[model samples]
Target: MAIQPDSAPSELAVAEALKALGPPGLLTGCRRIRGGDEQFLLPAERDSMATRDRKARAASGAGRRIVHELLRRLRCEDVAVLRGPLGSPMWPPGIVGSIAHDEELAVAAVAMRSPSVRSVGVDVEPMLPLPPDLRAVVITSHDRLGNLDQGIGGRLLFAAKEAVYKASFPLDGRMLEFDDISVDLKSGEAATSSGRRLLVRCTARPRILALAYTP
Candidate 1:
């Protein structure tokens, strides 16, 4: 069943859920884009024991509604959203988009008329320390030894790479590794091995965040 905006969880619960996801810095400046006139109703109740399930469900539903509204605003009819073979969300015949959700937060980015916009992906992880081994999986040898310098910055780098991979998958139709992209921690930007630019920017302090729309 779809989730409904009317069922939105409390702000406190949403905040707590985002915190549990880690990387609080990512939440900085995250804004919700409304779907304007195209909002739709989603089922409010679902089976779940998680403390933040309701909040997360509500946020995801709101995100989906906003995407539909945005498409409508852009005069994009013929909208069809489906799951790709790899389970990535797919959009209508002439539209392209990406949707992401973590705990109580959900975000979506849609582009009209052409696949020329290529890839657009967003991810948000709470601000918290990560296990060394998992951290290693996210940062490349060069990044660990170079600009990233192995710390909180390294974690953000990892998150940025994850977002990049999410944004790029639809364009290339393949899975990508952290090493497949070069990220400049100082610059907050990522580029494909082939020099395709992927811009990543963070907002807020002690950040609760959103990373989106990689080129």
Candidate 2:
């Protein structure tokens, strides 16, 4: 969710946005997260990882905490969000979720532990110009390149495609590059490879946020 003019980015705002989606089992949250120790990790999560680096540990801690907090609110039992072979989150049985973290912000969205929602994804990124080296690979000629002159379009496109990939991956289990999905920034929607369409809703305040939900 986008931050309100009166406030900074926060969990309340994101929760409100998820509620507005009107899905019975959706729970969402965002945090200005920091790294911590093994205490933050569930036994299963701590044991499965191969890395012992502090920064990696901290990022994992923050993501798990945000997820647990939302489940706590929903009164659901806490379960570890393990790492899948492809590096995507392996949500517990009966749940569909997505998580993304940048240097300073971590955001997560989970469809209430049920079979109804097949997948859910949320991504947040700084509204900066796309780095030069990544331009050709991510931004296609079909996109409205004119927005690049103004500076926010490329980042939005990258973020939207990321959100779409996360939402679609569980079904297809295929990795997607930015060029794989085409987005209409003006409409906040993307064309999916499987002939189904995924809606990409975006909000930009301190950063750009895109959330995708698959049917």
Listed per candidate, the RMSD to the true structure in angstroms reads 8.5, 3.9
Query: Model 1: how far is 50 from its true place, Å?
Result: 20
lDDT of candidate 1 at residue 201, scale 0 to 100: 52
- Estimate every model's Cα lDDT from 0 to 1: 0.52, 0.68
- Give per-residue lDDT, candidate 2, residue 195: 56
Q: Candidate 2 versus the native: TM-score?
A: 0.81
Clashing pairs in 2: 25-112
Candidate 2 residues 1-215, lDDT tens each? Answer: 22221134455555455445424566766666564634677888877767788777777776777777666665567777777777788876667788887776667787654555667777888657778677667777655433445246777677778888998898787777777787777765677656546776676655677777765
Model 2 residue runs over 4 Å out of place are: 1-25, 113-117, 142-150
Query: Looking at model 2, which ten-residue stretch has the lowest summed lDDT?
Result: 1-10
Q: Against the correct fold, how does model 1 do in TM-score?
A: 0.63
